[model samples]
Target: MQWQNVAINKMIEEAILEADKKGTKVVSLGLMNQGEELNIYGGLYVSRHPKLKVKIVDGSSLVVALVLNTIPKGTTQVLLRGKLNKVAYAIAFKLCQQGIKVATMHEDDYVKLKKSFNSSEANLVVALNFTQTVWLVGEGLTEEEEMKAPKGTLFIPYSQFPPKKYRKDCSYHYTPSMVAPNSVENLHSCEDWLPRRVMSAWRIAGIVHSLEAWNEHECGYTMHNIDMVWNATLQHGFQPLNLPNHTVIT
Candidate 1:
């Protein structure tokens, strides 16, 4: 649908009003609707409707949590590519805290991402090449840039949208998602692009928020505690996906 952004926002505002009227506890923003470019991560709605009873959540923290857990084992370093959004910064910060190197391709990006960390944090330096096998990517990836990866390099996306698959030698993962436990009634089919029974972290975050009864909005520059959201998701029986050994396309 070629819906104009203003019309989309109007529809969203209408839904928020409807949900609030029905005593809905929380309303999570879907993919593009929560973008920094769209509605300031859903903040614009909250600012417009200040007296709303339903809390607005962007689910960014859980999105970051899922991306962090998705990184493969034994990775000492990973490349950070694409636009640096809210989730990108959080991932870089957590990885640096865990002593993992977050490599950048440009000095300008390095300078900008470096300011996010302190001297105590691990490396966030400019890498002249794609030496690391794991790449953490977000928006703004191009097909031309995708061709530069070494064979078998894994692309894990934190963006709401997935990147195009142009390199068959390289592997692409589904956007941040997890397996909903069997107890989740009637979850027999895939949720969007995810495999069967797997759910988007963004959707799961709203379920967790309501279960926890959190009254705060997680939109705009605000983020829920990553550890808290992850633990709560696990406590509520969501499990991380165990990727197959050979993930590369044939």
Candidate 2:
């Protein structure tokens, strides 16, 4: 929706009012609602509004935090396929800090990355800039030629909608450890306000936001440092993989 559209803005304003009525102090805007191009920081508008009575935050920062925490330690060769947006850059920076070798390519070059690195060498593959047109079907493996990761390879793909259908043939088929949930229902109910991906982002954002709020008052210091925020959020539980039944090559 157009950011300046009076109807959409009014709807957001109304949602803020409703949240305030319920004594909610923090409000999170997810997905398109918080896009920089459309809204130019819509969360800031709600936060600065005198009548809103809520702290507003866009959850992208938290998503970055989760991705960092999800990556396994001692992982050396990492392939990042996505636009080098702020989120992608943040992930790269964090990985560098951890002494991991990182390679990044635009979405169009994904096939090249696939041909170049297999699970035997690449420790992890993260697909951040995914659109409907781009997905995670393996390069050559298909329904008839099922392949498994050469043990220890990890794949993490972000989806704004329901995840695409799983391909049993693909290497590294398991979900990321940090974002996994026991079931889809645990992620969100049908009545939830946002789609699953957006909801997940908002949920993770709330985790860090709550910590920052507490640290400010209790520690007399702000937790704006991403590293500290990451460590703090790690105390919260991250679910393990819920993979489909398939042979995982070791």
Candidate 3:
């Protein structure tokens, strides 16, 4: 993985430059391209090419929007477990602001998230009870952890991929995504693990970004208005999907 870093970065840089040359308005970064460790979600390219015309979007805001909205209605509390990212942080903060309690399974994560809160010590608390049936899951979730969850627990993933189906009793949700509208023609193939006509939130974010003609670059740690992006996506006919937990749904 480390060996391919330089080559991949070079390829990405070249592609960005090529997009600029062709007058492409925006280029959206996919899941792995975020490069949380190597680059700050495509910030390296922006830093290297200050005058680059093509805007870059990591699609974090839209992803956050999808995750937040996809959360089961009436959920007052949720278990947040996974490797924390920009979107995770944003989701936690927004959840706190909305008065929804976010319980962290790890002490390190709890302390870090608490420090992120700054002054007000509210919402984020230790996970003593897996009483909450809904778990906001992401990468680094293991089979052992899945086993700890109560029976019939819904593991809703907010990442690029879904969790392994280790527990037959516990349901694993499809990655946060939206169903493409009937107007979307020429979509013969399904995207990744999503069902037919369902598009990843990342790709749909770019579509909304272009539709809105947003001038600001959405790359790096910068976040656009989550509600605004969600509303615009809906206005453009992108429908929120009832994510599949048991199996893929067409």
Candidate 4:
């Protein structure tokens, strides 16, 4: 009955996994409303290795940890479900500490994001002017610039606040043809091809084997989906047109 929410959550999780495989660090971020709701969504954080442990905490603690980039020695990641502003600041501060590059977005867009998240009116102005960060979520869609969020700003996509269905003609611009529909049909074994658009690096071993069996007559399907450049990363990598880190809030 509530399949949409499931799909959305799966999308975000898949993105994190795919991004992680590509060696891109991700961190989950969000703002918890009175009912503990998130506005910006979340992401995965990368560290020095694959099997690193992470810390999960309330929004405030996340901010402190991210701002300092000081997790306990065994921690490699952080997950937060809290206020949008605080989480954003933590992400920005931590990125700065690690010397990681970020992306920038248009100014008007930033203003709108601040207002939507109910961020401090005064701080909104200062944050907009002082930071060049990308507003990751907006109106059930992610800003294009979020793909490479800049330093000093939040990167949660608008879609994270109220997860929306993708449209073929209007709000979103992707076409079915953009994704190999036949390839999708052939991936029935996975029972969830839609998530692959964003989460490409994950192998889904058993499902992949099934796909291989189904395509035994053909020889190049894997290469088509694995070697070619799809969005920003290789076919086997996560390059979602919508920033992969954006959460699909429930």
Candidate 5:
């Protein structure tokens, strides 16, 4: 089900209030898939200044599904997406089935929701739990917000997912193949459709790292085999983006 800004804002406000009680400002890290776009799923933290220091990472390497796996069962995660689509919803449904409570909303109403929610639900606060995961869609936070994230926030990009769903809502032209392989390519070549975004993202970084992570017995990573993609991008002088260790950069 598509989440309303009210629910997500409430969750974040609760998180912020708890932070305030601890005598700390609200520290949040937003990971988006785009570099220039700042429209988060509800535009809660849209930068008003052009010089807004946001850390625009190469989301080109993130896999939404793998990140989802990182979240524990029975926990609620605030999901921020630019364009809510069926594929994403399908993922959420699967999580709900696993007992995960996923919160969703449009980008425009984020800040307002946060204010209202915190006012209403004082007990529903999000503590600085290292294990808690925040899933960001569209673009990463500006440099300023990155520094504000609580100790253990995983910042990721949007290219990790197919562009079909979000591109329409985007004003700029976004090439899905810029980082990850196409869905058709994933289905026809890899025999696995689910992890296309994940595999495609890693392939952009370094093939060796991608192969290592995919071959991990415990995780069982799968996706379209696109090792040649690395050779092309690297040949063009594109360096690997410095992402999390769970993420591989060339």
Candidate 6:
């Protein structure tokens, strides 16, 4: 794990250097790059680097905005499944603040929940980790059980399942990976598969941060500030979710 972190950080530093050479104004860290163990330290490294000319941003706020935007109109109950990382915790907190009821379960509890479910109870299920999402869809329940599952929506960042492999009749599925072409090259980067609108949202946030940084302006922004990020995403042509945007597993 220590070696992995060092390697990841090295890669990030190299990317930052490349961005500087290209005169890029900002660099945005995606997914695992902004994960719990690295976000703060990575930001500090970039901010303190004398030779780094570009600003560093993370996708946390943008992701929250996109996920919230995907919620169905009538969704009153939400289940957040994954390890309780910073991103998951923040998303849950915001949902509760908006008066939506939420339940949280770790990845280990997924099998137990799947077995106990007689009918779908959650209106929405947000799986923060791709592996956990795969487990939930594949081994977590039987086909009949999944078909009878009551969840209205399943939101995952990506999936390894083919488009036609999962039960579509049960829940609405949203994943960037689902729309990607069936080619190995297309699978190289998570960004390649992410829905265009979602990616647009993240880009918009990055641009805003870049502009602020360039102007020596402090907007006093943090990942927990959802409204600002959501508004920016809207400006970049993010379509609102149609209720029950259902699909089979990706």
Per-residue alpha-carbon lDDT of candidate 6 for residues 191-226, written as tens digits (9 for 90 to 100): 543343333333345655664454221111345366
lDDT per residue as tens, model 4, 11-61? 645555665566542232222211122212221222222352321112232
State the lDDT at 127 in candidate 2.
39
Q: Cα lDDT for residue 105, model 4?
A: 39
lDDT, candidate 6, at 245:
39
lDDT of candidate 3 over 43-123, digit per residue (tens): 889999999888898888988998898788899999999989888888999999999999998899998888877857689
Which pairs of residues collide in candidate 2? none
Q: Kindly state the number of residue pairs that clash in model 2.
A: 0
Q: What is the lDDT of residue 156 in candidate 6?
A: 39
TM-score on alpha carbons, each prediction: 0.90, 0.55, 0.94, 0.23, 0.28, 0.60
Instruction: Sort the predicted structures by TM-score, highest score first.
Output: 3, 1, 6, 2, 5, 4
C-alpha lDDT (0 to 100) for residue 54 of candidate 4: 26
Best-performing candidate as measured by TM-score: 3
Better of 4 and 6 by TM-score: 6
Candidate 1 C-alpha lDDT tens digits along 134-173: 8898888888877878888989999877888888788888
> Backbone clashes per model, in order?
0, 0, 0, 23, 20, 3
Q: RMSD (Cα, Å) of candidate 2?
A: 9.3
lDDT of each: 0.85, 0.45, 0.84, 0.29, 0.34, 0.48
Q: Which is the better candidate, 4 or 6, if ranked by lDDT?
A: 6
Off by over 4 Å in 1: 1-3, 117-122, 188-190, 244-246
Candidate 1 least-lDDT 10 residues? 241-250
Q: In candidate 2, what residue range of length 10 has the lowest lDDT sum?
A: 214-223
